[model samples]
Target: MKKIETIHAVGHVLCHDVTQIIKDKTKGPVFRKGHIVTEEDIPVLLSVGKDHLYVWEKNENMLHENEAAEILFDLCRSEGMKGSEIKEGKIEVIADRDGLLKIDRKKLFAVNSLSEMMIASRHGDFPVKKGDKIAGTRIIPLVIEKEKMERAKEAAEGGPIFRILPFHKKKTAIVTTGNEVFYGRIKDTFGPVVKEKIAEYPTEFLGQTLVDDQKEHIQEAILHYIDEGAELVLCTGGMSVDPDDCTPGAIAGTGAQVITYGAPVLPGAMLLLAYYEKDGKKIPIVGLPGCVMYAKRTVFDLVLPRLMADDPVTFEELAALGEGGLCLNCGVCTFPNCGFGKGVVY
Candidate 1:
């Protein structure tokens, strides 16, 4: 590495090893604020003369490099904070409750590690809207390199805002279809059981229709809800290979693409998925096997959140869901936020 030097001046200067300030010699040096001259660099610094030996450092500023970057990530990527590029060295962040904060370029270069300098928003939940103040970041000590500050400022620019409208509450439609249930011989115990499990949500009554060993009618009813804006359509019973068990057949008739007819999961192995586009919006239809009625957890436990989310369900997404899709069927069921389908960043 090319060694540079500066001479002693009227004021003290801060000097740290070149390797400490710069990760790679290729990247060059970044001096933080409030630094003072040291004897280690005295030989080099002396060559530059007294006045030129002055080191860049200060106390009060909007943000230091590392601190500013951390704050920007928390706001832009994690907390959905809004910011605008004012200039090469300037970024302006405005919060509804916290007011406005200005980020200076010089301050960013004054800090070490970006993680130390960044500030995240207070909000932790997803679906953050615009203008939310996730966190506040600022650099201490003023003087810093122009390029290094620019790099830090650029990272704080913009990021994804996982926002979705809560206009429609999640409502489930339960359809129980089987020749036995239609004949009214064993009593429809499955319908009530499925209802009890999802009772946490404000599930609306979408009518329980009894179909006699017919997949056509089952598929027709599923399509009816898709047209009527049903977020989830659950088909109970008739998921087996028996000719009379036509629930899978009914789901196939909907003209919607089915991601999986069955999964490797237990209890709900017979679960199926069919998706259709209704006016450009993707509609997800789930075929719940008879096991779901009795089993504590099933594939239903896994795909519910993704279905409720305002996003289209794809084969890749469904396949990825299989990892945590199996239910341990623990002594008790802690649903909605369970290990089966832990939350994923959208």
Candidate 2:
């Protein structure tokens, strides 16, 4: 750090905050610490002080915090992402569009391991909107060694360390299976629930097919939706072991690849995930357990964004969710922001 005449301190970052005061009116920082001095700032500093200011000094071996932050930003910079101007030596990376955020957690960890620097971000595979703050980078010290920045650059060499997979608009169809619903004994509530859950995604409900627990009827509905150009087919109810439950059988009967008959998550543990092939490309078909109709959030909530981005989940990945599978069922459901299904990432 260096102390210089306030007029000549232009272009240097402040080392300490300059407090401003007015009798009984205000007494707070006029210029925050780490603010870069500008030509206009001279008069402000002169008004607060006599003539001198403390500022960061240029050095060959040690780089200024802003410079270090730029290098870190460059390391992870990529399409669909942009960084803000340096503020207090910190730079925040933001998403450029609505999509599923993918974080290179392994590489992200490596970069943070370096001393005197830090990077923090939201978990990967979550949905994000335009301008959402994905990550932030900055140097811990006012300045850092040039070599540390080089190491960070090397750690994030390939494509951006963070990226977004844009969601593809999909025409969707729903199949509600249950003797009660099919026979009109009880109202079909599952169809509306599924639609509400996927409201944010680029999806439209083609139509709903209410059918009995007949496996053949369920298979027919799925095939009909695929024929109608439905990219996603969601089946609700009849997922339990009872003889009346036949949604899983119906999905398997259509020759669709069943990825998992049951997941590790509670409230949606009986969920079934599958893929149906039409022509050459495969379409996703999900069998929703009864709990989905009542639960505010479930495993389905955790996987919806990924599906909308067309990123399919694997059996092992769903199995691993058992770690953070149990929900606390808090009175106020914060969901995605909460700990439920966090195991899906770890």
Candidate 3:
């Protein structure tokens, strides 16, 4: 790149995007790279306080910022994701499908540690929608050493820095227990709520069995769903310590690996989570507390997306939810978008 007086820069290409900042009113690029400066543009350029300008010039050792940015973009593109067009030496990574985003954070830090380059992304393990901006990368200079970009590539050698895990279709079975609903004393609210939540994913409630608060009946109903090919078993109600509440134990009686019997998040603390693995098949069993039937959002809302994506939850992971677990229960609840059960940093 070469520096020249703005008056004498006519016909010369602007080497970089010149952003015009008008206090808080506006701040955006008015002159883009490769744009030929004209005599008419002199006043506009001077108005933006550009007395001197950087013009494009070829150099073997130094690489143009656009070329350098694409190299950084290539380092972040994985399957199920694509990149936006290079804009002012920056390219944004976007999700090609709606799914959970997984980031190679350790390698990401290693790459950023290399000078003159950066890769910024959203937090890992979060849900994302198609066309969502996942990350953005740029070369930190108008021009940079070719070797530095190559070094950044070496630092992120494990493939792309991130990938999207698309949600899988699962055949789910919901078993709502409690004598009040089983005997028609109260309407079955939990069953409809679970159905509505899982409907957001590529899943279907194959069936729902309404059983009384009897351990034997609840156990039998759950096993029947598994034998009928239910990949996800959902048990609602009867999760608390009440003598009549028996869903949590019924789920355990199936000989499943119970991950956690209680959660830290508000609105769903009594929730039970477990996994049944046999003959190479793993089915997740959840015993949702009664709070789920009332709260608009809870731990169930937070973990449901991950489970639908076929991402198994570890006991350690559930324990990490305490930090961002408390729900504000705002007047107008906006879950998933709100911080309710967002989980904390480890």
Per-candidate local distance difference test? 0.54, 0.85, 0.87
Q: List the residue pairs that clash in candidate 3.
A: none
Candidate 2 C-alpha lDDT tens digits along 1-346: 7778998988888876789898999998999877898999889888987399878877798887878888888777677889998866799999999899887877888888887888898877789889999988888887789988888877776437888999998999999998898899999888888988878788877999999988899899999999999999999988899987888999999899999998889888898999988888889999988898898888888788888998878888798889888988999988778778877545
Ranking by lDDT: 3, 2, 1
Stretches of candidate 3 off by over 4 Å are: 6-12, 19-30, 36-51
lDDT of 2 at 314: 88
What tens digits encode model 3's per-residue C-alpha lDDT throughout 1-346? 9999999999999998898999879998999998999999999999999999999988999899899988888888888888888877899999999998887877798999987888898777778999899998988889999888878888998458898889999999999898998999999988888888888889866899999989999999999999988999999888989787888889999999999998888888897999998679889999998888877888887788888888888888889899888999799876556666656546
- Cα lDDT tens digits for candidate 1, 32-148: 323455656555444333334334344453333443444444433322234544222234443433211223223333332443234333322222234654344444323334454
* lDDT value, residue 39 of candidate 2: 94
Residue-pair clashes per prediction, in order, are: 36, 0, 0
TM-score of each: 0.57, 0.85, 0.87
Better-scoring candidate (lDDT), 1 or 2: 2
Q: Residue 102: error of model 3 in Å?
A: 2.2
Query: Runs in model 1 with CA error above 4 Å?
Result: 1-56, 59-70, 73-157, 161-167, 170-172, 224-231, 332-338, 342-346
